[model samples]
Structures are given as structure tokens and as C-alpha cells.
Target: MTLVIKPLRKAVLPVAGLGTRFLPATKAMPKEMLPVVDRPLIQYAIDEARAAGIEEFCLITGRGKDSLIDYFDVAFELETTLRERNKLDALEALGPTSIEAGALSAVRQQEPLGLGHAIWCARSFIGDDPFAILLPDDVVKSDVPCLKQLVDVYNQTGGNVLAVTEVPREHTNRYGILKTGEDDGRLVEVKGLVEKPKPEDAPSNLSIIGRYILTADVMPHLSKLERGAGGEVQLTDAMAKVIGHAPFHGLRYEGRRFDCGNKVGYLEAQIAFSIDRPDLGDAVRAFLKNYTG
Candidate 1:
């Protein structure tokens, strides 16, 4: 049977977590708003989605996340000040921050359920369409946007695709592990998925990261709200249910992923991103050399 692939147009970003890990700083501000170099962490995810041809965005938000919305809105006062000061570069920088009126929307996840539940909150926006899900916590740096790599693979395979990477076998419990069928260096056939499995129970080291291209069929499973690992509705479990029904596969995306939900990873992303920036690279490199030396 020839599989038909939908043109990927929409992306859902689950930003409802309280970010308990980054407390104090995140106490008042949403972790998604934290600055990595200059732009906020969530902006990187949005930028990546746009690069992958995503036209509409749904932010599954929670309380205290009004700033995420504000970040995308035109800052009349700020823009006016920049214009008056003739700061053309500064004004230009804000361009990407604006979205067309109907291109973006937000839905509140009133409760802090699991990832599955947060995604389910966007059902209305995702009705009857295959969509992409990007977790802002997993900030990836790549020459080709990580989600685009998955989109390319999805175009060829026409089923659910996930961004996966090999993790240390001993640390398999930290991620959703993949059970494989075929062996291609860049893409692996996903026969099964296990969430936070112990090393002994883990099928393989290939861990599912934050990027996913899922079929609309998975929504029915998510709607069931079955709680799995951590006693929360596990998206992994729902996705696993679709394995036998779809052309499920995992792409070993070309990128460096930083777990920005944690302090260490967040700090690492800051330095890594700063060192890659044209405006900050030289000064950051010098500071690093002086500090390390």
C-alpha cells in the first residue's frame, strides 16, 4: 500500500511544566522564558519549527505563562523607543518575534499532568491532522534544524517519526528507549518504545528526544489518559500503542541536544550558543580561555 504523507504545517509546544528544577529564577518567570545567550529558550524551539516549515503553532501553557504570549506580541513601547533612537538593528531583531494574527494560539493545561496530558490539551488546534511536537526543554543545535531532519524522514516513510539519540546504556532509565527492527545508521525501525526503563529492561540505547511527528490517530489513545510511568499520562505509552498500526521509525537526528530543564544543561546551552554566535564568539572564547587557564 502506498502511504500518503500530509504536508506538515502545525507544531505544538508543551510549555506547561512548573519548571521546579530551576526554581527561584523560575519562581516568577516561566522556564521557557529563560535566556540562552540572547533569545529565550522557547524562541529556539519556535525558530526551529519555523525552519521546518511549520505554519501554525499551539503553545500548551499553564499559569504564570502569560510572558510566553507577550514575547511573541509586538512590544509597542519597545518598538517605539527603538524607532525613536534609530536603532534599526534592534528593531529588525524583533521582526521574527512577531507572528501573523491567526498563526499562533495558546491553550491552558489547567493541571500539571504528564507530557501526554499537556499535548492532549491542544486537540482542538490539532484536529484531524498529523502534527509536530517540540518540547522546549530539549534545545538542539544543528546545521539543519533537528525537526527538519525528522520531517525529511517522515516524508519518505509516511508514519510517526521521532528524534532519537544513543545514550549511555546505564542511563537508559533517564529517557524513553527505543526497541529496534532495522539497522540503518541514520534511521532505525522502531518496533517498540519503553519509557524510563531500567538498564536490564531497556531494549536499546537509542533514546527519544523532544521532537516528534505523530499521526492524528494517536489522539484517541492520548484521550484515554492512561497513566503509565510516574503515574502520569505517559505520551510514550500512547505512542507505543501506534507502533504496530503505523510505519513507526526513529531518526538519529544530526544535532547536539541540551536538556535545558536542568541547571547544568541550561548553563551549557548558554555557553555553547554564545560561542557559536558571531557577535559573542570572540569575547566568549577569550573569557573561557582566560577562566580555564
Candidate 2:
């Protein structure tokens, strides 16, 4: 059997949700724009995609989300100002980070349906290619890059690959749980998926994270708009339909994941990322010591 790995060229980011969890903070800004350290949440997700060799980005946005698109746009005035101030390094950094003119495209998800609907909105951009789907809420810090690891496994197996992590059994109801099959060390065959099953009903402790490499075939399933657990079209429900027909597996990624969608998780991510910064580590450590002492 000849193995051919289709290079994942495009990635879809569903940023259309009205982030009600953060409330007042999210009132003016898209939740995806919330900063983790210095970079916005979406920027981290885009950086992860860039590290994984993904070239094109398809952002599914909603009303008041123009800022998300503009964030990645070229800032002519800002660049000129930086140049006049002799801040060439800062100018270079800012320009390099914005998505190149033609590299990014956005589609509007007019209604705030669900994750499945948001992804379906980007169907035209996805075309016939196998693409990546990344949820900005689950931010993974890793040396190898989480999506890149899944891409590697997708190449060998030629199937849908999802990033998986072992969550506490008691917290199984909070995540999309995966039922396991033959274990191949890092890649575990996915027998089925249970969306937020009760702890006792969960098939396994392995919960699906936000990173996914899906075939275009998934678009049709997403279009079904079948309401699942929360009366919203669930992506897991669509993913479940494709199990046996397509080779579905989970990649045990090596990394630390932060759920920045919640208040506590957001604060924890800020602390973790701040401590890892070379310039701020000492000061942050000193502050922490003083506070705890």
C-alpha cells in the first residue's frame, strides 16, 4: 500500500461565537481577540497553523467580528509611524505577523448556530482538499506543535486525526470523549465518540481537544445540522458518522493545554505563558514569591 500525505494547505477557525462567558470584557472585543500574554488567542492559533506549514486560513466570523479580520491586515499607518520613530525591529515584527494579503479569507456565519454550522460556512474555501480545523479555546503549548503531530499521523493512516488528551474521569462530562480500540502507542484507533458523556458512561478518559484534520467529506455531514447534546449542531455527532467508513484515530499530543474560554483557565494560561517569557520570567517569579510568601 502506497502512502501519500495530502499537505494540509488550508485551516478553518470558527470565531463566530458570541463569547458570553467573559461578559463585559468580551462586550467590545471578540473572545478570540482576548490576549494571552501579548498575543491574542486567535494569533496563537494562527501561529500554530503557520508552524504546522498551513498556508491558507479560512476564518468563519460573525457580526462585530471585523476586528478579527482587520487584526491580520497590513497596518500602513502603524508601519509608517514605527519607521519614523526609528523602531524598525518592531515594525518588522508587526508586519511579518499579519497574514499576507491573499493568504487569509473570511466568511460570515450569519446565524450563531453552532460549531458544526460555523465550519460549514467555510465550505467553499475548503473545496476538495483535506483541511485543518482549530478551535482557539484550546491552546496547546508544545515543542513539536500539536497540529503538526496530527498531520504526521494523517499522512501514515490517510484518515481523520484529532488531538486527544487524558482528562480527569470526573470531568468527562465536560468534553467530547473517545472510545478506544487497538492502541498503536501514540495513535489510538477511535471506535466511537461520546459528546460530553457522564463520568460513568464515558468509554475512555481520552477527550478530544480542539485540533482536527478533516477531509472535505465532513462538509456534507456538517450540513446535516443535526442537533445533538445542547440543541446545537454538534461537530462530534457528524464525526461519529464517519468513523468506520474513514480511518479515524487520535494522536496523543505532547503538550500543555489551556482552556482559555473559562475565567480560571484564562488566568492560568496568562500566568503560565508569562513565566515562560525570558524577559519577564524573573520579575514574574519574584512577584509570585512575594505574593505566596
Best by lDDT: 1
Model 1 clash number = 0
**Residues 105-202, model 2: lDDT tens digits:** 99999987788888888989999899999999989988888998988888888879999999999999988999999987788999999899999999
Best by TM-score: 1
Candidate 1: segments with Cα more than 4 A from true spot: none
TM-score of each: 0.98, 0.96
Q: Per-residue alpha-carbon lDDT of model 1 for 1-293, expressed as tens digits?
A: 77888899999999998999998889999999998988898899999999999999999999889999989998999999999999999999999899878899999999888999998999999998999999999999999999999999889988899999999999999899999999789889999999999999999999999999999889999999999999999899999999989899999988799999899999999999999889899999999988798
What are the Cα lDDT values of the candidates? 0.93, 0.90
User: Which 10 residues in a row give candidate 1 its minimum summed lDDT?
Assistant: 1-10
Cα RMSDs, all models: 0.9, 1.3
**Residue pairs of candidate 1 with colliding backbone atoms:** none
